[model samples]
Target: MSREPNHRLAALMAEAGASNKGLAKRIREGAARHGAHVGTTHVSVQRWLDGGGIQSQTASFVAEALSAKLRRRITPADIGFASAPPPPAALGASYAASLPDSLNLLDELAQHSLDDGQPSEILLPDGEVDSAVLSWLVSRPDGLPVDAPASRRVGMRDVAAIRTAGQMFMRLDFLYGGGHGHKALRHYFRQEVLPLLNGSYSAKVGNALFGAAAEISQLLGWTAYDTGNHALANRYLLSTLRLTKVVDSRMMGARILSNMSHQANYLGQVSRATRLARASAEGGRGHATPRAMSLFAAHEARALSSAQDYRGAARAMNEAEKFLEQADTAQDPDWLSYMDEAELVGEFCHCFRDLKRGPESVRFAERAVALTDPQYARTLGFCRMVLAQSQLLNGELEAAVTTAGLAVEGGDALQSARFQRYVADFQREVSVHAENSAVQHLNEQIRAAMAQLDDE
Candidate 1:
């Protein structure tokens, strides 16, 4: 699997007039600024110069350092590593405060995504969420009605098209799973949305365009998260939040943060998740639609439950219920329409699961499964698996096996990383009961279904 040396990196270093030791020192220092303590040495620099693969984060730091030295942006792609876009400017930093900068950043991200860029596999630390939240909290909002001029005269039709595409993608994600529409969504952003942003428009139209772009980025981030790509998800989310600031759309901003909270929660960063959830609520504040408020509170409840704060989780869930009572679909954004009673019950099911309250978990899970839309086959199966787990938790072995068999029936209908994890978990739990004929039969059925899917 050996490959050619990355001559581009060596050339860049030479252009920057940095020696091996010098480049390593600068990269180490740059990583320190980003809170990544890399002990890069001259030998590491030599290895990179000789075309050896480096850690993605390390390569990012090297590009960042070179950018500073060369007075221009450098990216992993520029250095002949994997074709990743430049890591975004430090989240919430001054580099992210301007509208033109935000647009440029998102455009770059869109291009990378469309190129099928492979991000580093580094799992973001828990503290990374906290840092991003802090930056957002203190960040100044982008000024309204962009003053910059452009070449082409853009109109509302373009904006409407983007919004319409967003709706389509969202529905696809809901029905099929994040994996189904991800590439198509990225293509839309790159081919359709990027040019719209580059074109000229009146301030009113410009603002609308930015809002549409923000929503697209939010959905992109959500899909990336759903597909188990946390680093990529964070990049999209940061862009979404930044774009929201440019548009000053509090509801959209809140929803984006809530999505981030869910990602953090699933990563087992409960403390970070709780903070992100609260930040989501604060983002919406006085401007929040009832649906927005309910979703934010539900996110917070999930985080609290994960953190083992039962009382706080209960309070948050009650607050969510109160907000749900006030929800008016007419007043809410199209994006929030999916957060209906079934979804709310599903969220409650997760909270109870985290709290290990088996009977309650099973109750909510059953209700969620019953109420879920039939088109959302993957979600229905996932909820059923959750019910099976809860049944097992309550010592109903036979019932658990039966429910799990039902879930396994349509497990391959959609491509979902989360569903795979759920399946693995169910398999492990039932292994203890392998001697039981029911459990054995269910396992055989699941294995057959999965193997069939693989063959197809």
Candidate 2:
């Protein structure tokens, strides 16, 4: 299990005059230049320098960072990763054209993870991402009937079990975030859901089965996303889009595409984020409920905000608010039920914060924090961070520190890397004012609380 020291990477870093921390920052900057994001920390750089593995995509980022520093081109091979026959691209990263292909890709991805324990976190190129989005937009939503290819006779009861499990997973995800129960969810998906895809079913049952399978794929994608496993998460979502189309569920596909937009925004792919959000709206135009439409509009607003289009973002939010007012639970899917006033306000707060309208953000952030249900601690906690961040941006240093401390103190063993990044981002921003005693104390409080969460 011991890894040989990465002499090539180390030598290259030395030649480039980059320290571990500096190189890590450069790598992140490199990813950002490609309109993507990577959470490369100094510790991660140390691991790579010490011969620990880097994802193939991340290795490219590393080379890019060195290339920038040394004023020359660099490749993964130059850093020792591609010296042998290069490894294959990340599985499930590209678009799959057929049902069997999508299912097989998902199966192999799961098996690869279960087999090696460390799923490769390789990032895909931007063009591949664009290609997947384009494929989903053009592919037939009404898929050919699921061929009866297996002996197991799937029925309503079998489909119902998966639906019930999906609900349970949703509740747990809200309560504890994506890190909780993901492994078990994957196991159940591989064990209970994948096989059902090939089993015998009536047309009704086949459509129902594909919908259920798509739901699970969407959940798997979300859980992976929550954990900051960006590459894997993107693959899951791509498959989810294909499956949603297989069921001819334009509404579901809209939701899936909006989810993709959300992830793109997170990774700094602002242009793609906007494009996907618009696609979701276009594709779901006739099929989406008002609530679902509201959610879609919110995603559009988010992407526009990221692109710094204040007017466009405001227009989208107005649409979101308008749609939410007309939303009725009677007609909406159960999943869409969560896109209520509180959620829209939450998105409002996020948009305002992104735009640096601190006071407006504070007002909406406060409402989101107050309106969020207590049982959904992960969300409540995130709302608290937003509130703190808004306060900081507004120059309310005291309020910012106290709220951030509480957000951290309230943190439990809930394992969302996104949540951790929220904490880290605030810490990074607040550190500038650390000359103040209160800011210093809050910093200490944050570290202790984070350590406690990590321990648990």
lDDT winner: 2
Query: Could you tell me which 10 consecutive residues in candidate 2 have the lowest summed lDDT?
Result: 112-121
RMSD of 2: 6.3
TM-score of each: 0.77, 0.81
Q: In candidate 2, what are the lDDT values of residues 1-456, reduced to their tens digit?
A: 888999999899888888877787677556655645455656677877777666667788888889888999999889987843333456676677787888898886665331121332444666876777677767776564555567888899998999999989988888787857677889899998999887888888888888888888898888878877766777888878877767778889889989989988977788888988998888788888888999999999999999999999999999999888888643976566667788888888989999889999999999998898777788888888989999999999999999988887776523576777677778778978879898888877865664455344
The TM-score of predicted model 1 comes to: 0.77
lDDT, model 1: 0.76
Cα deviation of 36, candidate 1, in Å: 22
lDDT of each: 0.76, 0.79
Give candidate 1's error at residue 278 in angstroms. Answer: 1.1
lDDT at residue 29 of model 2 (Cα atoms): 53
lDDT of 2 at 335: 63
In lDDT terms, how accurate is model 2? Answer: 0.79
